[model samples]
Target chain A: MDSLLTLLPMLVKMAIVVGVLLLLPLPLTWMERKIAAHIQQRPGPMRVGWHGLLQPLADALKLLTKEDHIPADADRRLFAMAPVVALVPPFLVFTAIPFGTPVQLFGQEVTLMISDMNVGLLFILAVSGIGVFGTILAGWSSNSKYAVLGSLRSIAQMISYEIPMGFSVIGVVMLAQSMNLSQIVAAQEGLWNIVLQPIGFFVFFVAGLAEAQRIPFDLPEAEGDLGAGYHTEYSGIRFSLFMLAEYLVVVMLAALNVLLFFGGWNGAPPFVPEPVWFLLKVGFFVWVFMWFRFTFPRYRYDQLMTIGWKVLLPLSLLNILVSGLWML
Target chain B: MEQAFFLLLAAVAVTAALLVVLARNPIHSALALVACLVQIAALYVLLGAPFLAVIQIFVYVGAVMVLFLFVIMMLDVRKEAQVRFLRGPLLPGLVVLAVLAGEMIALLLHSTRLHAVMGPGQPVLEQPSVADLSLLLFQEYLLPFEVASVILLVALIGAVVLAREDGASAAKAARKEPRGAAR
Candidate 1:
């Protein structure tokens, strides 16, 4: 009975987080299309609802009703499982992300986060890393040349960029002297890490873009070359799952950027709540990501690899050195 | 309850390990290995070493297994499916397996003696905090740690060198075989 009582709040929080993540991509897809259309000097998605507000719902319905597809040559089991493998890890990542500090609800002080491991940052990184398997499995199981090539490119890009991404966070970890995300945020309460570690922020942002497979880093799904890349063989709801995962990753990256660099939930003006500040910051970052997607051209695969290995890797290492000295 | 959870995890791990060996498809075997590794990671969490568990997933399940899958895919091992897997004599393998099983049974039967030495209700050792673990790794065992890293670096260089040589030879062969029909 005591354990059940303890578990109830967690179950509630999990449901809320999952529900929010599932619904987030609806508005996000609409916003992304609108932003892309405007950037290209055109109105977008006006047919479904006001400014195509109901467009994603329509898309969801169409996708659900569409015939499920599997190429005859494809591995049946893995093909069916790929989208799920891709989707779950990104949702799992939110288990560690804190939207705000603890708040009183129903006479209980409930944390905004689902779990607060001492190694929260590492936990997020490790789980998110597993998301690559989805792409790989999808590509392999499809038994298509383009899918294979795209997945190969993606895995290589992800693996290369992950080095710089992991290293860039070292500066923040050193500055905060803790791997706990909450503590890292607290350490930045006086001054954001971005102010102290601009180079780290730059490397983290670029590598993060690559990690999330956003343009100009989206070589894995390069439409011009790979014909929709790893997901070329997917259709309907399964395809939507992959898109949902991608959008969730974008949100995760945006939220992570806010937490690590911009001081998560900090700098709230009087009468404004911490979570509101956090959401505003995260929203701005998400917009910035979309803005970059529209503004920049996709990178050449070789060029992407070079930037990750040669430029970002060394820059992040240098930033770590500078941060260590600054700490001293 | 804890014991039950541990048993469940152990059962899954053992099953996955068996699948890794028994599965005919190389990709299936690799994925089974991943499942086994993940179960081991859960066991780490059960034993209260979450840092180890996370690293296990990050390094082995995430990176290493992905590489394994890449190699399996790149090799185009679909044809390898038709080949027989177990070729060795069964008697020696069974004898070795029996001996190992006997040893494990003996160890389990005598585990009470080991517990007696350690005192009651203290089954698992307390894991050190991450900071202390890092301190031990960096300060106390710094030499060994550095040496291990240097060895890894050397192995990496060696792999690159071997791969380069293979690529060069393959390129030479390709150049020599003009209008080769047997590609």
Candidate 2:
């Protein structure tokens, strides 16, 4: 009973997080459309409700009602499994991220995060990397030339960017002398990592953009070229599952950026709570992500590879060297 | 509870390993291998080595398996359902499996270290924290760690050298053809 009582807060937190993550894409998709439209001097989806507040709801209904189809020659089992495989890893990543400091609940102190594993940073990186399998599986199982080519390009892009992304965090790890996300955040009480390791922040942000497959790194889903790329054959909820996963990744990256570089919940404004502060910072990054999506043109495939390997990789390694010298 | 969890993980790992060898499609084999690696990582976690478990997933499941899938996909390797994997009498394979199982049983039954430390009723060993693990890795086993890294570096360089030779030959061919010549 004592153990059960202790587990109650964790179980509740998990429920809340999972609930929010599922519903999060609704608002995010609406936001993306509105932003993209506004940027192009247009009112987006105003007919749905009050400047299209209910647009995402309508979209969700349509997707839910749409007939899901599997291509004739596609691998039936893997085709059905791909979206689910893609959806899980990003959700698993949330388990390790600290939302705010612990709070008292039911006479027990409860952490905002599900778990604060000592190797939280590494665990997030590792688990998030596994999300690639979903894309690869979806593409390969579709049994189409476009799907295979798109997935192959995506895999290459992800693998290339991951090296720089991994290296970029080493500077923060060195500065904090810890791999725990909370510890890394706490270490930045006096000064944020971005102030000390600006180059690291830049590299991480760029590599992160590529990792999330946002434009101009969105060659994997180049609609112009591949007719919706890996998901050309998918329809209805399966396609929406891929979209949901993408949005979740964007949220994950935004939250991670705040935690690693923006001092997480640490800030001025004593009246505001810590979690709100974290959310505000994360929201700003999310906006930046959306802004980039609408603003930048997609990079040519070879250009994307060159930027990842030639530019970002070298820059991250150099940043590590500089950070080490500064720490010394 | 821990014993039951370990047994579950071991069962899954063994099954996944079997699937990896038995699956006709190369991609299926690769995915099965991934499942096997993940189960092994879970076993690592059960053994109280979260760092090892995470690295196992990160490197093996995340990076290495992606490469394996990439190669399999790029080459368009598909189902060879018609081909027999073990194209001979089953006797030789059965003998090998029997001998391996027998050796394992013999080692478990007779090894003093196993009996002293890991046998039933023996207390479990204390697990080292990640900090302790890293300290031991960097301080006690630094030379071996560095040597392993060097070995990996050599392999990487060898791959680059091999690729460079192909590039040079391609470049020579391009030079001989000249710009905008006949098809």
Please give each candidate's TM-score.
Answer: 0.95, 0.95
Model 1 agreement with the true structure over B18-111: per-residue lDDT tens digits: 9988889888888889889999999989888889999999899888898888888889578986665676677887899899999999877788
Please give me the total number of clashing residue pairs in predicted model 2.
0
- The TM-score of the first chain in every model comes to 0.99, 0.99
lDDT of 1 by residue, A1-328 (tens): 9999999999999999999999999999999999999999999999998879999999899999999999999999999999999999999999999989899998999898999888889988899999999999999899999999999998898889888999999999988888899999999999999999999999999999999999999999999999999999999999999999999999999999999999999999999999999999999999999999999999888899899999999999999898888888
DockQ, per model, reads 0.72, 0.77
Query: Once model 2 is optimally superposed onto the true structure by TM-score, how far is the C-alpha of residue A143 displaced, in angstroms?
Result: 0.5
Where does model 2 exceed 4 Å of error? B79-82, B113-129, B168-183
Q: Candidate 1: TM-score? A: 0.95
Q: What is the lDDT of residue B130 in candidate 2?
A: 68
For residues B38-58, write the lDDT of model 2, one tens digit per residue: 999999889887889999999
Off by over 4 Å in 1: B107-128, B171-183
Best candidate (score: DockQ)? 2
